[model samples]
Target: MSESNTPEQNSQPASATPPKQESLLANLLINIAIPALILAKLSGDDWLGTKWAIVVALAFPLLYGLRDFLQNGKANFFSGLGVVSILLTGGISLMELDAKYIAMKEAAIPALLGIATVVSLRTRWPLVKTFLYNDKVLDTDKIAAKLEDNNNLGAFELTLKQASWMVAASFFLSSVLNYVLAKVILTSPPGSEAFNAELGKMTALSYPVIVVPSMIVLILAMVFLFRRIGKLTGLKLEDIMAAHHR
Candidate 1:
């Protein structure tokens, strides 16, 4: 005979699904290209004007961040910083502040990250692991197990500490580049059409100027970490990397 389940059994919570990953193209278009285009092309006397243009350009990133958070069902450190950065930019432009403030704002984010990356080395969790050596890209659990078996776990930690410094260097590089780029590009006074166009120019240039160099350093750091992991654990690169990457 078939039996019916109790209400308690039937009311069990559904399994939680993984958070959706943001697409790189969508992120770039929303945060960089579209905003830059709007600020550059639309910020004119006949178009959106200085105030409205800043508002509209900043809105894309703000809305995109909100949507990403909603899709993930949580907040992240970088996303929170992005929101703060947007607010600061909007506030400065709307208030017609000095152009230097915008440059400082651009530099501050990466500077803060560089400081945090250095400081986190003293703690149990290093930012290097979060950025490079994490399970998202590496078979961390397997590597850890192998390290333990080989009595190289302490050695691995030392290697991670070195890699953390390298990561910090990348952040510092980005911070310097950001400041210089901003100081050079954002010369026009804030809340002017010329200033808006300059802001757009800075945005367009930032990817190739600041981001690419920082990314190269990060890639080098990752390679260094992987090589050290292989030496310590005697694992092949194919085995060291996560299944998805392989």
Candidate 2:
């Protein structure tokens, strides 16, 4: 006869299964391509109509967020926020207001992130570290040891905080560009084919229009950061950037 089972025995199956996670490209397709496609191809006076198309298109992103929550028992920050943004964007579009509301929705996300980046400086973990210095890009452990060896840790942290301000500036710049791009391109009243077509154009142009410039700023931040790190640690630039190659 078997011995009496404990609660831990019964819970093993649930805990042992690996969680399902969506791929980055899949997530982007769900969020950006699906919505843009539905709006561009289906949203028109003769098709699903603007209101219904927007509602239907919005469902794809919401489903992505729901899937994330179900598997992990929690939502990813960007994923959850993407779903909420879609809801707000859809709701605003359905309000029969001018096109500017959509433009505002587009701008609000980056603007808020910029504000949060500035606010995070007051906390223990500055957002700059995650953006530019995390394990994926830069090895904090190796740098920490180097800093301790050289007695440069304090100065390094100070440099990171200063870099965070520049990061915030880049985000604010993107926020302004986002608003202006939407206004200039999204002139057709919401829900029309012209509107949907323009939306597609904006989506297509975003990489070149907004992302390229923002990346230039982020690249500059990385350059300034590495240069400071080298100065503080007395390490060669190649030695300091070994974190990236590894």
Question: How much does each candidate deviate from the true structure in C-alpha RMSD?
Answer: 6.9, 8.0
lDDT of 2 by residue, 136-169 (tens): 5555566778899999988988898888988988
Best by TM-score: 1
Collision pairs in model 1: none
TM-score of 2: 0.77
Backbone clashes in model 2, listed as residue pairs: none
How well is each residue in 1-246 modelled by candidate 1, as lDDT tens digits?
012245533432222112223367777788899999999999998999988999999999999888879978999889989999999989998999998998899888998998999899898888987898887678888899999999998999889889988999998999999899989988887889999999888888889999999999999998999999999999999998765555
Q: Stretches of candidate 1 above 4 Å error?
A: 1-22
Clashes of each: 0, 0
What TM-score, to 2 decimals, does candidate 1 have?
Answer: 0.89
Q: Where is model 1 poorest over a 10-residue stretch in terms of lDDT?
A: 12-21
TM-score of each: 0.89, 0.77
